[model samples]
Target: MEIPLSHFEEYIDEPLLKRGLSYFKNGFVHEPEEIRPGDYEAVVEGSEDYTVKLSIRNRVITEHSCDCPYDMGAVCEHVAAVIFYLEQEELGLTQNTKKGSIKKAKASSSKPSKRKTLAQQVDDLLGKATHDELILFVRELAAKDSLFRDLLLASFAQYNPNESKTLYTKQVKTLIKVARGKYGFLDSSGAEYVSNELSSMLGLANHYIRKGNHKSAFFICTAIMDELISALEYADDMDGHLTDTIYDAFDTLATIAQEDPPEEVRKLIFKYCLTSFSKRSFSGWDWHLNFLHLAAYMLSTDSEMEELFKRIAAIPKSSEYEVKKAQEIQYDVLLKRKGESVAQRYLEQNIDNPSFRARAIQDALDQKDYEKATALANEGIEQDSGYPGLVASWYDWLLKIAESQNDTERIILYARYLLLKSHNPKRDYYQILKEIVPPEEWTNLVEAIVQEAMERKPYYRTDLVASIFIREEWWSRLLDLVKKEYTLDQLAKYEKLLAQHFPSELADLYAERIIRYVENHVGRSHYRTACKYIRKMIKLGAREKADEVISQLRQTHYRKKALMEELDNV
Candidate 1:
């Protein structure tokens, strides 16, 4: 509530905000209207038009929604552009110079009116351009930019699929070459760039799909998947964007296959999937499993399905991990093809495996057979006796089923076990218990968890204990926990929590950390780090203490010129 214009930076990522601001200034945001008291809507033109809606309460942007396929879980550029527009309007800094011509409002005093934006100028010029002139301009522009040419061709390919098939394939090859760097390595950024380019091709393929050019779409999707998969060896796609893009391409091919494409197209996709799966290099990767799944989906005949399973069974299981993965893939394919009864029988044969047991429990839950689900989960937990992590997962599954059924008693029972006995307990367990248990009982439960953490030898997970103390505002206890020797980094981690609730203690902790930092190291970087802590100490109202520590360190380390130089700089 009551958000100021400056507060926009707080809600949006800096890069996105900058892009949005550029969009606003370039007049990409159009027709922003306050639809209600504190709600605004606008259209932002990017590759396509996107609708942005914002809800303001008091002066703060309380909610933002944008119908753009941006998946970063933050306000998209469209939303940010609309906010920038609203901010400009609020500041009396926007005006329409002519019909449908937006420009920033200028000062009234004698200065010539601000020039129209480049976009505005472009629109005006384009409106005045003759048809032949526009075509000549585009032709010259496309000639100068290969990407422009490729995109133009791709767009045309959607309409004339047969004529542009070779062009589309060439573009895919060019993209792969560009994505794979000179040294045959695509780093994270390279992978991201490649993925984005592949997505553009996907968009074109989808356009073809929409136009009933399934053959062209299938070819494009397969080409993308094949090229991207080859590039995988040359790229460090740790973020998995490139792989995900390829998966999307595979999914597209699956869609085309399912649509009963021509026999030739179906055979092509099937061969690609099966050939990719057969590669030893692709074995044991998630893509390998997905390829099998896709192949299973594309199998149109009983003989094909039987051959698919046979191929999977024939794959060399060099390790138990590979064996398990192959089994899991087989089970998934079986489940998709056969009914639950048949899948259940297959699952029972592999039930000794913890994973299969988990799958069995999930299957029971999916069927809404709560009793069977509960029995299977308990049996899995019992059978996986020595694996605490597996047992914890089973308990989590049970807790989820209980929550689904709203069985509060069972939830409490499972949550208590999870909180106490699970190898890696989640904060959700604490939260669920808090919501269900009586407020009077909540404190005792938290205290017990914290006390158990404290009693563990060599101080186990003090962060968890500290979290509880911070959450409950048990500042004194939190201070006690941090009173021991801690590195500057450790103290910094809790600095804000302590500063807000225990300023005096935090100041003291900073003073202690500052002294330790100076005493331990004599290098320039170390001295700089120590000076940083000293400044933080001073900022926390420990000026006298910080001064004393710095003076002592300066006098003690006076012979070290580099350290003294850093101190002098500080």
Candidate 2:
């Protein structure tokens, strides 16, 4: 939510706003520091003190983030409290209001003593208790609380003789089940909770790995991967929290593979990888083939290599990415078992794979085989014409080769072409042309580039031409481009950039667009948005123009009560 600092209460939930206001008046919001212009950081004292950071631009809260455990809504009370504290004057709130509210809240409370967090209270109690008392307390809680008992058992499982993967697996499954909602689905919050809990388990695995207890770590990692992989089916996972947990599990496993563990541990992981891959356990995911990548890292015997090759061959060519991965894996296998010469041959045989082509191109470049590199890159450009990003990369390689050979003609040709058309442009190709082209012809070249950009579809090349105008300090031309469109979005985007040079012109354009916007759109939300621009017009030194826009809107939209009400806010 882009919070407009002018009337933030209208944008946030009323209940949330009230809570935030209470928090602000109670002095929970610490003094916010302007870390830099338009950027603020404040610590709001709460259950656990949370840090809130806000980005204010043009008197609007453009972005905000809080490091608190409140994910159910976009704006947490901590963030709101910080916003209120920052915008007190704009909100017509004064220090006396905060003082009076604090006094009122304190007078109404039965107990006004300062609050301590639950962890603080627990620590206070723990510090007073004896060792024997702590032991007795744990025994009593574990005896009555099944959840506590499982946690206790799992936390200390390293000391128990019967500690096994099953124990941790059951613990993780319980977490998933408990986090599920009435619909048997894990919402975003539920998924986040599960991810954090499983991440804790992975942390334990990481501790064991660092301590060289590979077996214990292996049990924990595999247990998580085994259970949570399936739980993802019913999870909303909108934030990819659940998916990240799975990646963390594999990362732990990768650590074990990297460490030269005991044969028992190595073989255990090797077998798990092969079995999981064969069962298509992680199918429909790119990580589906990651099992093969992991097994390749630990290949030990001829039998293992043959079996891995067979599995790689069995992967269906379902997508271009999958096919590329499979061929790359095959090349890696050949490189490992056969040699670079054999791998090079295999790479050439499967040059359709972009990864293989890139490797081959790099290898050619490394050996100073410019002709071979050029041929390979051009072939890739032709083959991957549909993939503009890939073609851009190939052009980048050609540019590199041209630079290597000091081929001026090809450099300008490729650089100019890339500046005009490469979808995945690497850097300032125009700058490269500027430096390389003779100064006498630079202006002409720029004009040619601008004309090329302007000839494309109106919407397609606006950004391209605008980039040229900005780079060349063609502010008038850039303003003209915005005038060609005169859209609210483009006006807002370029207003700040153009305001200093052409304030009156930009203001008039804004007034015109704001009227068109209101004429075409209805409702108070749109009215608020339109008024937001009216404020921009005022800021651009167009007070008269802004007033005219407002008067026209009021006269034209007098019948819309909501519009009239929102305009009054402006």
Whole-model lDDT for model 1 versus the true structure?
Answer: 0.74
Clashes of each: 3, 0
lDDT of 2 by residue, 1-570 (tens): 688776788787888788888788778887676555566678988898888877677777766767676767888888888777776655555432444642222211111214553456677899999999999999999999987788778666778888888888878877887677435777666787789988888888999888989998999998888887898888777679988888889988999999998898988888888899888889877567888888888888879888888887777776667667877877888888889998889888888888888888888899999999999999999999998899999999999999889999999999998998865578889888988999999989889888888886633677788888888889999999999985799878877778889999998898899999999998878989998999888887788888888899889889999988887887
User: Looking at model 2, how many pairs of residues clash?
Assistant: 0
Where is model 2 poorest over a 10-residue stretch in terms of lDDT? 104-113
For each candidate in the order shown, give its overall lDDT on alpha carbons: 0.74, 0.82
Native-to-model Cα distance after best TM-score fit, residue 334 in candidate 2, in Å: 3.5
lDDT of 1 by residue, 1-570 (tens): 223445677767888988888887777878555555556668998998887766676666665666667758557888877777766745465644336577865342111224553456677899999999989988999999886677677545656635544766767766666655455566555677678887988887787777777878877886776677778877767789888997788778777876877787777667677777776546645667667777776777767777777777777766556656667766776777777777778779978667788777787788989999899888878987888888898899899889889999989889877876654675467678888999888888788888887777664868777877877888888888888647888888878878877776787777777777777776778878888887888788877877787788778778888877877766
Model 2 CA deviation exceeding 4 Å by range? 1-162, 181-183, 187-196, 239-241, 284-286, 366-368, 457-459, 522-525, 559-562
RMSD of each: 14.0, 9.5
Clashing residue pairs in candidate 1, if any? 2-59, 3-59, 3-60
